[model samples]
Target: MPTPTPSPDELLVFTGSYTPDTGGNGAGLAAVRFAPKTGSLTDEPRVSPVPVSGASFLAAHPSLDVIYSTNESDTGAVSAVVRQDEEVLSPLGAPVSSGGANPCHLTVHPDGHWLLTANYGSDTMPGSVAVHRLDTDGRICELTDVAVHEGTGPVAGRQESSHAHQVLVTPDGRFVLATDLGADAVFTYRLDTGTGRLQRIAVNRTRPGSGPRHLAFAPDGAYAWSADELSSTLTCHRYDPDTGTLAEVSRVPATTVPDVANQPGGIVASPCGRFVWVTNRGADTVAAFRVTGTSLQPIGEVPSGGIWPRGLALVAGHLLVANQHSGTLAVLRVLPTGALSRPAPAAHVPSVVCTLAL
Candidate 1:
């Protein structure tokens, strides 16, 4: 039989893993093509021998020619690679240190001129957020500026310092938002497109003890949603799109606490703008929400049927979940009602897989 070719609109996922060291996570990469029908998948194309040890997170540029990875380690760094022609390519040069430890996530500016990273590390020393400019060749140029987060969250014991977990620029590219798990707040910053600089706007605090992680914006960009990893809840904020101000509107529990505490890592809105999905590490499941304007109501929760749900991506119509502990990837059918079912194209991976694509 001939190898299945991907659809014109089909998205291919690139993920990293840790399979070699039994004591350590595996070191491998994977490529899976998504199918639009019934939201299923065909097969996983093995692409391994990645340079990074623990490739935890990934970001694809808006322009779609380059991709980046966060090599999660105590010695944190970001690598930029291109997908030139039809091949998966390597970084144009060496990786750039994020100026902090365990750089967990990276995001590109909507203008495609700069790249930003969040460092999740220690309490006292905390972590820092750094900015990097991109060259004409789609490579990261220089480390522009770095900001060290100060102060602790409301939690007496846990929030002893700041851990910047995620950084994202608004859809409009006017402001940038960074979430601090230890600080329990989303720090808003103004982006300078030409100079590649970040200026502090305002630090919006979440409910006490709610360790904010990943964030998603509504399709119309009128509302913003944040997932609290420590608290297992989703907070809705009324956003002034022009001014970029966020006012907390409501806070709803995501499947109740103890079962969902380590939840809210990969939070993303479906491309159709009808549903939102968030991955729970503790529950090993993905929570589905119905999106009505800015209001979000929990509709259903589906088991990923794996050890831990780490990363999530929607390609064509299929929902892909990265199973960190089980050393495999799970594909699910996404219903029009925003529910998930039917697992297929499941395969064993090396370590914790973090998938991103063009």
Candidate 2:
């Protein structure tokens, strides 16, 4: 077997089920020092706390001293936490509620001065995106603004109203993209860094039944990829950085799994922008794709080797998967050909799995 790239000194994981009502707090977040080059983990992994109701989505600040997570509640909130050390992370303070409901995803500004959240809720009440200012110490302050969305989807039962699932910022800090599952559209917002404001720029519809969930931009910033959970498809868009607009270039099936019930979960591009991967929870696999311009061609599917793979992260050159149902983090070696292999048994956690990073 070919030797693996050297692993980072430590890895930290955050699970979603930390709540006082559930007999816990951030205590479910765990950390371990690992040697990926040798495929070995620490004798005893260290665990930490991430304060939030449901750690559904996580984002690390570009500068790496802070992390943000969506609380994902019926009455939802977002928590900003400071990374104190290798095995320590504590909440900066109380989580700021998303000001709508069921807040699901979040992203930090490139300047690290603001954070945005997507609140996914029912139509009777509607959903919204909230913007907050982050101070130097990583504590969130200044509840500046909220943008409510309208319109319903084609699926009557599933799309009665707005359900904004993710909020993403362009690498240059010029724009923010919010994906609405209910509306099946990606809304662009022009960001004002000084005032921490979001101005609606454009709304691009995905496939009618697509139910856009999450998005990731290519490293080069030439294209953006959106994962449609309901339609099981991926759409590529040509991103205009100067204007902060998205133009759909192509649409392709997100997975080759024969099971039609499988739902797409996470969408992420390789740090190098050469490959894209999407998780299929019910199919228990990860779909790999090669990118050319704004088009994506499926490479293949690899068994995630666990149940309900909800999240994917890259740490020290290894692809780590948080298998929600299996309660274990599966580690895969990304081959040069863009393939992933069954992991050799290493770090394991029980109950729920959410994120893995170093």
Candidate 2 on 1-358: residue-level lDDT in tens?
Answer: 0112123444444445444443334334445555667545542645455545677667777675677777765777788776666556777788887777877677777777788888988546677789998887768887788888876888878788988888888877678888899888888898787797779998877778789888898988888898888888888988898888878889888778775687788878998888888888888888889887678888888877588877777666667777776766677777887777666663554434457454
Lowest-scoring 10 consecutive residues by lDDT in candidate 2?
A: 1-10
151: Cα error in model 2, Å? 1.7
Top candidate on TM-score is 1
Q: How many residue pairs clash in each candidate at the backbone level?
A: 8, 2
lDDT of 1 by residue, 1-358 (tens): 0122345656566776653432346664456565555454444453434565556787777765677877677777788877654435566678888778888889888777788999887543686788999887669888888877765777676688898999988877688888898888888888777787778878887787898888888877777788888888888888776666788888777654353346666778876678888888888788889986567888878777577788887765666788888876787777778888856647666565577654
| Collision count of model 2 | 2
Computed on alpha carbons, the lDDT of every model, listed in order, comes to: 0.74, 0.74
Per-model TM against the reference = 0.90, 0.89
Give the lowest summed-lDDT range of ten residues in model 1. Answer: 1-10
After superposing candidate 2 on the true structure, give the runs of residues whose Cα lies further than 4 Å from its correct spot. Answer: 1-9, 13-28, 39-43, 350-353
Name every residue pair that clashes in candidate 1: 17-26, 18-25, 18-26, 18-27, 18-350, 18-351, 19-26, 19-27
Q: Model 1: how far is 141 from its true place, Å?
A: 1.6
